[model samples]
Target chain A: MNALLNKEMRLSASILSYLFIGFGLMTLLPGYPILCGVFFVTLGLFQSFQSAREANDIVFSALLPVAKHDVVKGKYQFSMLIELSAFLLMALITLLRMTVLADSSVYLQNALMNANPFFLGVALLIFGLFNAVFIGGFFKTAYNFGKPFVSYIIVCFLTICAAEALHHVPGLQALNAFGFDHFALQMLLLLGGALLYAALTWLSYKKACENFEKIDL
Target chain B: MSIVELKDVCKTYPAFRLHDVSFSLESGKITGFIGRNGAGKTTTIKSMLNLIHTDGGEISYFGMPLSGHETEIKQRIGYSTGTVSWYPRKTIRQIVDVTRTFYRSWDEDAYRKYMTLFGLDESKKPMELSEGMKVKFNLLLALSHRAEVLILDEPTSGLDPFSRDELLGLFQTLREHGVTILFSTHITSDLERCADNIIYISQGEIRAECSKADFLKNYGNPGETLEEIFLRLEREAKS
Candidate 1:
């Protein structure tokens, strides 16, 4: 735990440089899926890329008196911390729009409450898949710069493009219609997303630890 | 008793391999790990620290197995590499503040003492410091925790002679205070001045591990230095 705290503090130094701009963009995006997409893609890939460029990042941490496994745990914890913060900030922005824009206040609030969970569910899936590939690949090679990062960026770009395109599809509209209006369905979506996020996160953490332990610095 | 021991440690890379390296550093002595570039000195050190996973063999530090007691053993061990580690943008103070939280036995007074002695500016970032200054800063961090054993990789590569001498003097002082020191460097003169023991590695294998006195006595003739002896030995090993 102490090791994780120390690592988080170190990671915070790197993450702070990107936080403001990432948060600002999150606040600016009005559409739910797009906002979540941008948030997940930008925060996730950017931080991982920052870490990769540091090259000696994991080696430096490994030299410390902490367990290597704790280093992996710290990374997952830090990523989740950023994602959770973005989620909260987006929620706040949605609230502000609900109250300040009175004409669409009820509609926006209703849309946010009902539709957001589904979008976040989709966000969870994307974030989970992104981490599995990124973390697994990064740690496995002990961080080679090009392959993992650029590939993940392409994946994220394609995912966001596909989701944004799907928003207008007539067939999926029926599913979105129910998902965006029903409280129970939205809660289910949120729960399901949360579970997927947690599971992928744990799997990534475990995978990272295994890969890192095999690395000879 | 030895403060650190490596028994038949093996590691492999695509281009290089460490072949069953074995050595031991007794407590409160300075052991100079010497070799040419890419001769497995750093690989041996990294394997002992478990930073580089070993394919075979065992390493023990402070009388405990390295694998089982990594955290505890590392707590007593201080290490620095050739390059400055940590974020380049972070000020010395910021890095220190963050790093101090990892160790329970971090000595604030020792830190302040070294920081003052080194004339390290708390506000300056790592990249702003000269290479010599960076090494000193890293030594300060390693020494600040009252570490029982210090392992450094090429700690005096790019420094002026005065800075190198001062660092060597500090190593002697720390040795007198009962801290074991193991450092790898190509600079034979530094080791000649302060090393109690010399461990020579070449071509991924340890050629010799002996007291400095025995090394000069055995391999060196009158007026021959460690540099000359190292060259002769390396040539012999190759032949």
Candidate 2:
């Protein structure tokens, strides 16, 4: 598992993603999660090219002592690790800015500290769901050039639009003392996001793997 | 006994197809799968790995059907694609590190030795290296893991003359060490130098199969190259 991720993939991607994040930091555009969302999406697209065009995968790994499932699974794990790492880095940055870097505005500090869990949870949820759709859909598209464009559009919708919009759903009427069902909403999104991601991840992986078996090598 | 076997492996698609392809690679013998561009060499290798599915046929590696024992079969087989590359941003060290995790029999000594022998910088990113170096690194990764069978596609392509000779010599040494290799190349000299048996494939099927000795004997001229034979066959097929 470590062998595959040890791939220099991180540097180019990290550079690209952090470049965006740095821009986000400068502009305060919720850079951490969505930027990571972009990162995973880019990684998936890149890997799809690696597997499809160069057939780097066709030659390098097709005969290595690894299972088809493990190969897909390895990519999945690596993407998750990247997402988690990105999220924590952002959280720390947010924390540092609030406590030390920025002037300690009492009102701002209280709001940030109170909303910390909600923001962190939301970012993680966003990253997970986006990674799932992009990674899953990209490979599925790579294996065939047919109508996967529809899927591509759908994945984009899920990642940027539908998935992100869940936070704004009308269920906020169920309130708690601290911050208006913040924990409940996050848990709902996270758990539901996880299950949906799991299913989509597997389907995409299985589709690719089974599709693999039917082709030449 | 046959070291590898393909029986009735057929898959059809809108733009391409591999018909009931059947062939065998013998234990302790080197085999060359000769093919023109798009002649199903890559397909066969991919199907054998179960990297792609076969519509109808069974593949066996080391006498066991490749159906359920895919990983184990792959463990014994050291394969390289006719066309292959590394992730663009990866260093040789990173590629090796990633490959090391999968093979239980990975030999660090072999890996390090090949790295030094190939004059490959461990830290150089794949994107920065030339095509030849990338090929060398790919071969190094596949070879460093000790396995009984080597499935190589166009293994010598993009190599400098010196590196190509040295690598061919390395193949001979591995053969002496009891590795059975399958290779494909337009470079007849490399195949003529190293292969023990040859399987000529053209147009998604096996065109000819024979030992290196028989090839030499039947061609009836010491100077005639495998390239000549391949071109002759390809032209004949075209006609």
Candidate 3:
């Protein structure tokens, strides 16, 4: 399994994926839809998938001395690794925003989503959605990725819009709280998001294995 | 002893189907899997390797069912297709580094020997090699793993006559080392050069399976070449 993951990084991974991890720093941006950073991270993963397909990575892995399901597992592991790395970076930025940077006028006056636990939670949900929609859809055929990726893009943007809109709703203003103002509730959302990410990713990996098994190639 | 066996194997698509395909490969011999394009050669090979799921049938390697033993079975078997475009940007050293980790039986000495014999540059990527060199590279990886059985699909396709002959000679060398080989190709001359057995498929069905001499004696007249016999069989199938 470790070998397969290494193959994914060295052989199948596009350089853009590593570069795109930097997008997580966007959480520091004021008045911007910070969740776009999550979308870009996933987009970077999508490029890796596209390049891998072009290079016949699946066929190569299939020929290896591993089970078909292991191939799916390797891919999911690689995706999760990238997603979590970006998430951790974003988490660090959010911590900074909630502490030392809390009183910065640029952030305090920002009308968009704030860099807080709630935002990180929403980002986790977006990551889950990508695992479910894009990775799951990709294994159905294992070759055609354009539709799955486009679908993920649409779903992610819609998620971003919803996350941005949730704070404006009456009584839900704490969902966007900054500087530990609603610390307890924000932590709960973060925990829920983590659970959802794990569930969605596991389910996606299972479905991808089943779908890939049915494919002739 | 039979190194690989398939019984009543079947796979279906909307446009084509592999109908109860069955054959057994003799240990330590070259078996040419002859079939025209779209005649299910690749499908049959893929099914044997469990790369594609079979609809109904049993495939066994070394007398054990392939179902629960895929990893073990594949560990001893090496598979390569005609085109070697995979990981076009990764150097040969990088690919080998990853591949060697999968097999517990991997032989570094053997790998170094083949790499040197094939004159493969460790720094060169797949796209940098010529078609013949690409095939040799694939063979190098297989041999490095100490694979007991090598299943190759159209490995000679698109090669110049000299390169094709060179590959045929390598196949013979491997066979002499007691390595079981299943070489799939539409090229009859390749079979004539190295194959001791022949398993012919036409229209997704096993048309004939016998020793090379027996196949020729049964299917060919005094002057009929294997290609001529194949064309005749294909024509007969259509009619």
Candidate 4:
């Protein structure tokens, strides 16, 4: 497993993937939709997948002394590694916005989604959805990725819109609390999102292994 | 002893089907697997390795079922395709670094020996090597792992005569050291030079499996080469 993951990092990874991890800093943008950072991170991973496919990385890995399922596992591990790295950065930036910049007028008066636990939860949810939809879909044929990515984009944009609009609903404005306001509810949402991300990624891994096993090559 | 065995292996596709193909490779023998284009040679090799899921079959390596013992079996076997187009940007050293970790039996000395023997530069990437050098690099990796069985598909396809002869000589040397080889190729001359056994496939079915001498005696006319015999068999099949 370690060998396979090393293969992914050294042979299959694209430079864009590392560069895009910095996109998590976009959370500090006061008036912009912070969740777009998650989208860009996933997009960077998508580039890795594209380059891997073109290089016949699947065939190369399958030739190794590992089981076919291990190949899928390695890919999932690499994807999650990238996602988690970006997530950590986003989490740190969110922490800064919640404490250090909480009283700043720019963030206080901002109409966009604020950097809080709720936003972090949504970011996790988006990462989970990308795994479930994009990664799982790519393994179905292990060749065609366009349709799956398109489907994920549609679902992701819709989720982002809903997240941006959720706080505006009557009596639900507390979901978007700034400066750790409604801290318990925000923490609960964060916990729920973490759990959902784990569940979705696990399911995606299972589904990818099943689909890849059926392929002839 | 049979080091590799496939019993009634079956795989179906929209346009082609491998119909109950079966064969076994004897230990310490050079067996040439010959078939024309679209004749299921690659399919058979892939099925044996479980690179492709067969619809129905029993495949075993060293008497253990492949399904339950894939990694163990694969550890003892080395497989290489005809081309070397994967990981074109990574240096051979980088690829070898990743590949060597998978095998507990990896021998650095043997790797160094073969790298020198094959004239492969560790700093060079796959794209930097010629077709023959790429194939040799593939062979170096296989031999580095100290595999008991080597299954190669068209390893000599694109090489010049001198390179092909060198590769055939390497096969002879490996065989002398008790390596079991299943070599698939279109070049009958290479097999004629080194192969002890022959397994012929046509239209996804095994047409013959016997010693090279017996195959030649039964199928060839006086003074006929293996290539002539193969062409004759192909012609007979078409008619």
Residue pairs whose backbone atoms clash in candidate 3: none
DockQ of each: 0.54, 0.40, 0.76, 0.80
Order the candidates by lDDT, highest first — what do you get? 4, 3, 1, 2
Model 4: residue B161 alpha-carbon error in angstroms:
1.6
Give the worst 10-residue stretch by lDDT in candidate 3 chain B.
Answer: B157-166
Candidate 3 ranges with C-alpha deviation above 4 Å:
none
lDDT of 2 by residue, A118-157 (tens): 4444455555444445555545533443334344445544
Q: Write the per-residue lDDT of candidate 3 for residues A149-195, one digit (tens) a residue.
A: 88999999998999999999999999889799989999999999899
lDDT of each: 0.74, 0.63, 0.90, 0.92
Query: lDDT at B25 for candidate 4?
Result: 97
RMSD in Å for candidate 2, one decimal?
5.5
Best by lDDT: 4
Q: What residue pairs are clashing in model 2?
A: A3-B98, A212-B52, A213-B52, A213-B53, A214-B53, A215-B53, A216-B47, A217-B46, A217-B47
Clashing pairs in 4: none
Q: Which tens-of-lDDT digit does each residue in A16-36 have in candidate 1?
A: 434533553454344344445
Sort by DockQ, top down from the best: 4, 3, 1, 2
In order of TM-score, best first, we have 4, 3, 1, 2
Candidate 3 - CAPRI tier?
A: medium
Question: Which stretches of candidate 1 lie above 4 Å from their native place?
Answer: A1-3, A9-41, A92-114, A161-174, A178-180
**Candidate with the greatest DockQ versus the true structure:** 4
